[model samples]
Target: MMLLDSIGSVFSVIALKPIIMLMFFVIFLASIGKSIGVRRMYVNMLVRIFEYGRQNIESVRKLQYSNLNSSDVDEVALTTKELSTDSIDQSSNSAKINNVTKLNGVVTQMVNGDTNNGNSVISRVESLILLPGVENCPSKNRDSNQQDEIETLEFNLSNCLDYVKSGMEAIIEDEVTSRFEAEELKNWNLLTRTNRHYEFISLRLTVIWVIGFFIRYVILMPCRVFICFVGVVNCVVGFAIVGLIPNKKLRIMANDYVFKHTFRIFCRSLSAVIRFHSREYKPKNCGFCVANHTTPIDVAILSTDHSYSLIGQRHGGFLGILQRALARASPHIWFERAEAKDRMAVARRLKEHVSDPTNPPILIFPEGTCINNTSVMQFKKGSFEVGGVIYPVAIKYDARFGDAFWNSSRFSMLQYLYMMMTSWAIVCDVWYLPPMTRNEDESAIDFANRVKSVIAKQGGLVDLVWDGQLKRMKPKKEWKEKQQEEFTKRLKGE
Candidate 1:
C-alpha cells in the first residue's frame, strides 16, 4: 500500500507541474491583454494605422490641388463629386482636367488681349516649347469655335498657337504634379515600412507567437509535404494504369473514376476545402460547360464529381503527355492555335461531340488562358457555335490562404503544382449557373458574351472587355512602369 501510494503521488506531481505552468503562462498573456488582446488585435491595429496613413496622404494631395476660384467653383464641385464617388483613375482624370481648365483660362485671357504684357503669339509658342518636358508634347488642333475666335481676333494661324500653348501648359502642370505625387508616395511607403518593422520587433517579445510560428513552419510544413507526396504518387500510378488500358469504353470509365478520386485526394493533400454551390437550376444534358479560366488546377476542382470531355490547347512536356493520354482515354479535343486546319477540325469535333449523347458534356474554358481570378475575360466564339444548352460554371478561389492564380508566363506547370501543394489549403467557390441557350438573333460572339456576362455576374467578378490573347500581348510602357511602382510599394509594405 505504501509503494502504491508513493507511485500515485509521483504521477500526481508530474501532472500538477504542467497544470501550474499552463496557469502561469495564461496569467502572463492576460497581463499583456491591454496591449495585445490576441494575434488578430495586431492585424486590426496594423490595418487601422495603414488606413489612417492613406487618409492623411489623400488629404495632403487635395490640399496641394485645391486652387479653385469663385468662377471655377462649379468645376471643382464636379471634380470633387468625381473624386468622392469614382475610382482613383477617375480622380486623376478630374485633376488633369481641372489643371487644364485653369491653364486654359490664363491662356485665353492673354490671347483675347485682356492681359497683353507685350508677349506675341510666336513668343508665347517659343516660351512653351522651351519649358521643361514641353518639347515632346504632341500638337493638337483646337475646336472649330476656338479656331473661329482666333481668326476673328485676327491672330496668326501658325498651327493654332493658343491651343498649343494651352496644351503645353496642361502637360507641364501634369508632369510636375505627377513627379511630386510619386515622391510623396515613396515617402508614405517608407513610413509604412518603418512602422511595420517596429511593430514586428515589438511582437517578437511575445513567447507564444514565436513558439506557434516555429511549430507551424518547422513541424507542420514537413507533414504537409509528406502528405502531398503520397497524393501525387497515388494519382500518377492510377493515371498511368488508366493510360495502359486497352479497351476504349473501359479506359474512359476507369479514367473518369481515377481522375475523380485522384483529384479529391490531391485536394485533401493540400488541405484544400472545396465548397460547391448551385442555383435553383442545375445543368443536365447541357452538352457543354463553360467556366472562367483561373488556373490549370481548375480542372481538378470542376471535374471532381462530373465526367466531362476537356477541350484545351496543345501543351508541352509532362503536361503534354498527360494531355495526350487524357484525350485518348476520353473523347476530348486538343487544338494548336497556330494551325488553321486544326482549329477547323476542332470546331467540327466540338459540334459532333455535343450531338453524341454517349459522350459527356464538353468542358471548355472559352477564355483560352488563365487570368488572375479577379476578372473574367472575353470568351471565344467557337464553343458557342455548337448551338446547344450551355452551362456556365463560375469559379472563384478564396486566395486568403495562398494565391491560386497560375501566372503561366512567370511559372511553369511544375512550379505552379508545387506552389498549390505547399500552400495552406486552396479554398474554392464554385457556382453552377442556370443553363443558357443562344438567342434566335444572336451571333456566336454575342452568345458567347451573353454567357460570359452571366458567369461574371454570378461569380461577382469584373468582366474584362479584352480577349485572353490580348492579355498576353506586351503591355504599354506606362502600365509596366505603374506595375513596377506598385511592386516597389508592396515590397516597402505600403
Candidate 2:
C-alpha cells in the first residue's frame, strides 16, 4: 500500500501536478537573483527579447528558445539596406585569382553551417545548390564503386556580378555589379526574411509556460493529492497498482505522438491567420525515404503526411544534441560532409539503414542541398544507389511562400512559417512516380535527369530547365534497362 501511494505520487505529478516543478523554478530564480544586479539584467533581457521579433515573422507561436533567442533576432523590418560584409571589401583580391579553384570546397563549408574565419564568408556564399550527380562531387568517388571522370557546371552567370549596392540602390561598377544583383536576385527566389517571428513566438511560449506552470502547481497539484489519497484508500481495499513499468519505446512513441499532435494542432490553430495547408504524411511502415531538397522543410513537410525515420545533416551544440536524441530514439543517419575519411562510411551506414526492416524508409535529398524552389538541381547518387526504386517528387510551394526557400544563410524556422501565413499559402504537389532501378552502365547523372524530367513535367515550370547531355540521350533509362536485362539473360544462358 505504501509503495503504491508513492508511485501514485509520481503519476500525479506527471499528469497535472506542478508543485515540484514550481518549487524548483522558484529556487532557481532566487539563486540567480542573488548575483549582483542579476534581477535587473534578467528582466531587461526578457523585455528586450519580447521586443526583438515584434514585426518580422507572420505568426510566432512555438517557443524554440535553444535554437535562437530574443535579443539574437532583429525584428525591425528587413530594409533594402544591402547585406554588408567584410568580404566584399576584399573581393578585389578574390577576383584577381584567375586560376581554377574548387568553389564547392568553400561552399560546402558554408553549407555545413561553419564559418571559415571572416574572409572566406564571401567566397563561400553559394546561392544555388546543385543536385548530387549534376556536378562531379568527391563524396561519391570515395566508395569502391568506380566513377567515370566527369565535368561540373559553374554558376549560371555569364560574368562576375559582385558589386556594392547601397540602400536598395544599385551601385553598379561595370559587369561586377550586374552579376552581384543577379546573384542576389537568383537566390531571392528563395525568399529571405528577418528572424523576428522566432522572437515573437519565444515570448508567447514563455507566457504559456508560465501560466501552465502556475495552473499545474496551484490547482492541479492539490487535485492530484486528492487522487493519491484515493489511491491510498484503494490500497487497503484491493491490490494497489504500483509504479508503471518503464517502457522506453512506449515513452518514445508517446513523445512522438504528443510532439506530432501538438505540431499539427499548433500549425492548424495558428494557420487560422496564416496561409499554409499543414498536414503530415501517414506511412504504413517506417523506412528510409528521400526527396529532392527544394526547401529544408522537405523532411518536415513530408513527415507531416507520414511518420518515418528521418536522415539529415548533423549540427553541433544544442541543436545537434537534440538531434542526437531524436536520432537515437527514431531512425536517423548523420553525414559529415567535411569528413573526407568518413564520407564513404556515411554512405555505407545509410545503405544499412535503407536495408533495415523496422526503420521507416531512409529519406535523402538527392539534390544534396537546396536552392530557390524553381527547379530541381542535379540529383545526388546516394539515393539512386540504395534507394533502388527512386520515388521522384517535386514540392512546389505557392509563390507567396517565396520566402520559404532554404539557403546557406541562417533562417529562423518560425519566421519562415509566419511568412507562409501572411505572404502565401504553403502547397506542394507530392507525386509518387513509379520506383526506379539502377543499371550497370548508366551514370548517376543520367538517373537524376530522368527523375528531374518527371518532376518538371508535373510542376508545369520546366521552360527554363537546365538541359545537359544526360537529358539529351533519348529514352536513356529505358534503353539502359533493356540492355541490362539482355545482358542478364545472356549470362544465365536462358
Candidate 3:
C-alpha cells in the first residue's frame, strides 16, 4: 500500500505539477535576454571590425611619398585632373600607345632611383599600369612628341595610382554596406513579432500544452501502449494465418486481406486520413510501381489500398519485426543494402519479381530514403531497368495540420510516433500518375529522371538533381574529381 502511494505521488509530480510549465517560461525569458544583450554586442563588434578594415584601406589609398616636393605633387595632380575626364575614351590609339611607353620608361626610372621606403608602394603602382590597353599597345606609336609624352606619362602614372586607390575604397565600401545590410536583414528575419492573434492565443496554447502534458502521460500514453500491443498481436496473427493456409492461391488471398486490413486499422489508430487519388490508373500486373517516400507510415498507406510487393532495405527494431511479418504474409523483398555489393544481382532479383505474373506489382521507393516531403530526391535506376510499364506514385502530406516528416537523425521511432499520434491527424494525398514506358534506347538513369520529373511536377515538390548521396555527407574533392573523370570516360565509351 505504501509503495503504491509512493508511485502515485511520483506520477502526480510529473503530470499534475506546474514545474515543467514554469521551466519553459524560464528558459524562454533567458533566451530573450541573451538575444537582446549578447546579440547586440556581437553585431556591434562586427561593425567595428568592418570599420577598422575600411580605415586601413583608406590609409593605404592616401599613401604619398613623404620626400617628394609640393610643386612636383601639384603638377602631377593638375595633369591627372585634366586627363582624367576623357584621356582613355577620347585619346587616339596612337596617343594611348605613346603614353603607355612613356609610362613604362618612367616606371623603369623610378625603379633605379633613390626612392626611400616607398619601394614596395612603387612596385604596386607599377603593377597597376598593366591595365587592359596598356600591355598590347604597338611600339610604332612610341616615338611621337617626346616632350608632351613625358608630361602625359607622369600625369597618367599619377592618375593610375589614384584610380587604384579609389577602386580599393569602392570595393571596401560596397563590401561593408552589403555586410551591414545582410546583418540587418538577418536580424529582422530572426525577430518574431507577437501580433494580436498570437497574443490572444499564447495563453490558450500554454494551457493546452499543460493540459496535454497530463492527458498525454496519464491517459493517452496507456491507450497508445495498449494499441501497440494489439498491433503486435495482429501482426503475429497475420503471420500465423498466412502460414496455416493450405492452397497457394487461397494463402495469397488470405495474406492480402490480413495484411491490408490490419494496416488500415493501424493507420487509423494514429489518426491518419489516408486518401488515394486517381485509383483507376493503377499499375498493370507484373509491372513496377515507384513512389516518393515521406515516412515509414507510407508502407501502411500503400498497403491499405494496393496489394503490391514492397522492396526496401532490411530495417531493425519494430520496423524490422514488421518487415519480417510482411515478408511472411507477402512476396516482399527486404534486401540488406550493406551486403548488396553486386548491383547486377539486385537488378536480376527486381526483374524476376516484377516479371512473375502470379506475384503482385512490385512497389519500390526508388528514392532509397525518406525525404522531407518538400522535395523529390533522385530515383535509383535499379528498379527502372525492369522492362515494363512504370507507375509513378507521388505522396504529399499536409504539414498545415502537423509535420509528418520523420527525421531519423533527430527523433527515434517511438518519439516520432508520439508526436504524430498526439497531433490532430496525419493527412496525406497519394496520386497514382498515368503509366509510362521507357523511350526507344533510353538509358536507365534517363528514364528514372524522366519519371521523377513527372512525379515532382504532379506533387508540387522541388525536383532535386543530387544523387541522394550528398544528403549523408559531402564527398571529398579527389573522389568527386575521379567520379567526374570516370563519367567522362563512360560518355566517350573509353
Alpha-carbon local distance difference test for all models: 0.61, 0.42, 0.61
Give the clash count for each candidate.
Answer: 0, 32, 0
Query: What's the best-to-worst order under TM-score?
Result: 3, 1, 2
Candidate 3 lDDT tens digits, 1-494: 99999999999998745654643333343323222243235334434543443344333323423334566556545555556555455555456455555554444433332223211222232222212122232121334463245434432334334335535643544211221111111111111120112112234434543554575456545454555556667787777779677798998788767776666556644545656899988776788888887788888778777677877887898788888887876777777777857566778877888778878888888888777776777788888777888999888886533467666767898888877666544667889999999998999988998999999998998776544544455644754465445434333433
Q: Highest TM-score among the candidates is held by which one?
A: 3
Cα misplacement distance, residue 155 of candidate 2 (Å): 30
| Pairs in clash, predicted candidate 1 | none
RMSD vs true structure, all candidates: 16.9, 19.4, 19.8
Per-residue alpha-carbon lDDT of candidate 2 for residues 70-89, written as tens digits (9 for 90 to 100):
33233211111122334444
RMSD of 3: 19.8
Give a tens-digit lDDT track for model 1, residues 1-494: 99999999999999768755643443333223211333245334434544554455444445434553555656655665665655668558867677757765654543332332211222233332222212222122434565355445532345344445656774644221221111111112112211222222233223433453464456445555655555455556777788788987888778767666655554544555566786554455438888998787888787665667888888998578657656645677887878889978998888888787767888889988877676777788988887888988999876544567776777898787766655445677889888888988999987988998999998887775555665456434654465445334323433
Between 1 and 3, whose TM-score is larger?
3
TM-score of 1: 0.55
**Considering summed lDDT, which 10 consecutive residues are worst modelled in model 1?**
178-187
Tell me the spans in candidate 3 whose CA falls farther than 4 Å from its real position: 1-201, 208-221, 476-479, 482-494
